[model samples]
Target: MTKSISYRFALCICVLFSVANLSVADTLTVTWTGAIGELETTIMADTSADGTQAHAVYKLESNKTYLQRSTIVLESSCDIVGAAYGTGETPATIQPIPGDDGASQFAGWPAGNIKTYGEDQSYAFKNLLFNGVFADGSTTLFGVLATYGKGNTITVDHVTSVHNQVITYFCFGQEENWTLTNNTAVQYSCYPAGMYFGGFWWGGGGGWTGTVESLLIQNNTIEGAHGQAFVIYDNGLVNRTEGEVINVDHNTFVNIIDWPKFYRHGNNTRWTNNLFVNMAANGQTRNAANTNIALNNDHVGGHGKTATLYQGACTDSTLLADGNCWDRTNRNISYQNNAWMDTPELLDMFAMEPWCWDLPADSNGVVVTLCDTMIANQSKWAGDSTMSMFANGVYMSNNLHMSDRGWNLDPVYITAQTTRTRDWLDNGVHDTHTDHFWMHQADGDKITVEWPLPMDFSYLATSAAATHCTHGGPVGSTHHMDHPAGLTLNTNPDGIVASTFALKQNYPNPFNPSTEISFNLDEIADINLSIFNMLGQKVRTLTNGTKPAGVHTLEWDGRDEMGQRVSTGIYLYTLSNGSKTITKKMALMK
Candidate 1:
């Protein structure tokens, strides 16, 4: 009996020990130590109810690579000084003492921070940081400093960095599929950028000369170091030498005066739908073929009077080059009903990069300053090769400088917020970014030419209708051009695109009592207009048939096919041809 009791007690002790160990293993903390290390974590997809990836583990070591196909979380304290724990270097670089700087207790300090390896491995990062390489007097930090041949993918979210020399890039160098969203980057250097902003430290080894190809810079807010401006450069060295595509959309460039310098947005890069205020493109003239529309960017207006607002000079005109084939390119480009505001007092709009589509102009001789500019050109086949200034210039009523803008000619009146101003350049006062401009018609009325109603299409044609004899320029400073002769751009809002199909917002969105929706078909086509609820349930069908395209309006009574009223908090309306479908959201009020 005594022997049996002893055995039972021993077994009980083992069971308790196992449970204790499991509990402790459930939670793990990462910190700096003498040795470089990696914390290998397992990732199981479909563990969550939705069958999407539910959980993952990350392991990385100080000064040692975590290898590829791995993810690790590098965290720093909210304190400015605590940022020191983020980088692989010893915290002594920023905080020589435990609390000397804003460094926090990571259970392991600077020595414990980890680094990653990307080449010949699959690696990714989610919610990571590389922080604190600065003097106690200042914080210098970097986030992720990537250097390697392109391998795997990386993703970072909510990555924050202090504007310090040492702890700079929250996520620095990158290659391949990088999706960085909602990140806050603050840099403070004498020159401001310190080491964090650019991956310059990555050196020249791994094709490090140029910007990463196929990178998406989306939804990020970057604040340049004080006194130091930001410029997005095209690194000549990249994995794919030809046809690289980088998309810089939905991102905010704040306090960054000079725009990215390279004329090519990485071979076939896209710069669209971004907001640029209080900054300038800094003389960066992008080519239409190489760089997509420099579209829908707003000038903050506050910088209008300062030299900071002037974006360098147009040193490159890739858009005008022969490879662009200009109109012959048959390239697909579009605008999303974007808005720009310029006051009535600023002139010299020609200095800005040319917008691919037509811009606003003033009727009634109401001169307006340009918020943006573009020079349309004829197709390469036309052999003229000059930018057609898509507006008519009346030198005291001489249409000699007139170029056609193809949009619906209509009588519309919407007063500009900024009153007309004189242009100092032409011995005429200029307008700000917001003053109203006109296109074909004066006094808000479309020019009637005894032609078809939609003949005033946004696409300018010199009678062939197959070609767009472009809107030329105050061009390369020399202002040399070859087009339909004497065309010049005025501050007009009737630039071709919007006038084609004015897709107005639905009334009483989330609505009832019948809301009116309208559209303009450039030509006849089979079309279907539909309304759907948030759940993707079909709520209403407005129009479905073959119709001549000009301008047409339809009404939705917030009712289903049977004309029965439906409840709604939010609904989506979709328009479709046989092949292309576009859906936009609308709300119903009652």
Candidate 2:
């Protein structure tokens, strides 16, 4: 829809409803209109004194991309506690203030000039689809002037943009007086359109005092940078700047040609769980490596066809390279504690192959062998959970029941499977999908699947309860099962339902900060409740103890093992008794 029509419709309805008397609620919506074009934003916010609550919506003309010299400040008199900013599709959730005192203001300055509110006072932006036209590097997409104070919190989690010629996502100035945690740039890749620099850049200097200590860079996926993915420069912010901890973890960078430079200032940094591919001419570079630690990272396609690993002026006991893997060889391409040298003359151990810096034996990395030609072909039919290939045909699996489709099939009971490939066929021939017979017991205890290793395509298949089932396919031609019959409920002649356990849906489905999870027990049983991220990594363990024969509730404060608040994302929580295990998915908004 066009912005003018959408804006007119919203304004007309808002004005129409203004006459009706309504009870006061905790939420308020404030709108801002730009002078030129149809540029407007409406934000709904929570009115608690210190509670973090804000959501914004933007409407712009069809051709118009950005607004100039305009700012939208929310209508709230209460002091700013915490704030978050992102797109409407992906709301940037506010992380908890670890030591908030309810009266503390998070923004650096008091509310004043409207233009500087986003940086000076606390504010957020959403639904901004701007195509930046920046030639010189002087302009910043959003600049936050650093002012000294405590209890400051800012997050820019979900932003989508292009034409980042000189566009910086966030620019912070001098004086460090806040803790930035639980920030993310996930799922979407920040592609470099024009002249490229860092996708997310920080630094115009920081405070000398020890207010800000740590920077957590996690879960970002970026593509093709001309400069560095992250750039941190020094302007004398702190004396021993290298002593401050910087964690760069769980990010994927594709085709960063020139730089992923962690130069002089970012000495005290740990690069972990990162995947680097196509670091073209300037393969990964590290300077002032006295305090840098790189571990457990996977890298492929360096400066040239020969995968390159570069180090500058790093001496013994200075650079710690361990448990890192690379696509360097035909097989077993993994290493641990890879010894590196300063120059080719120092290659006395491996004389013929002087570039062999990593120790030959006792390597700590795992390598898998695959030809360059086979990598693309084999990747198509590999790693998917639902589609498996045998010597004869391809096997498939799905949750939807399709037994009535004139094919011999069995029911599949597994609910948490994501690898089921739909409509997969091998060599345009026979295929079997989800033919495992699942038998549900009287109690909600154990459900098992019984299937033979190899099936005779010529014979008739049998069904449960002694119901004779015949194979149906192209007559006289060999074929496998076509579709899956989902879970089948087992009942006795009396028609009484039986269940030993039940897990209820979490209250307040999309929640902020905290939520309650409840479950029921038919009899006394030991239980284990845990939370896992989409990547299957356990975020937190809620409980590991015994429960009685009743309903029990547990509250999660959206924290991990170290009591740090987690980012906004989809999480899975599982309730596992000894006999049966059930899992459900939930969303953490902030």
lDDT of 2: 0.31
TM-scores for every candidate against the unseen true structure:
0.32, 0.32
Candidate 2 lDDT over residue span 152-214, tens digit each:
223333233322322233334223322222222211112222222344445423222222223
Error of 2 at 389 (Å): 49
Q: lDDT per model, in order?
A: 0.31, 0.31
lDDT of 1 by residue, 354-419 (tens): 344223455765643332231121001011111111111100110111122221213121111011
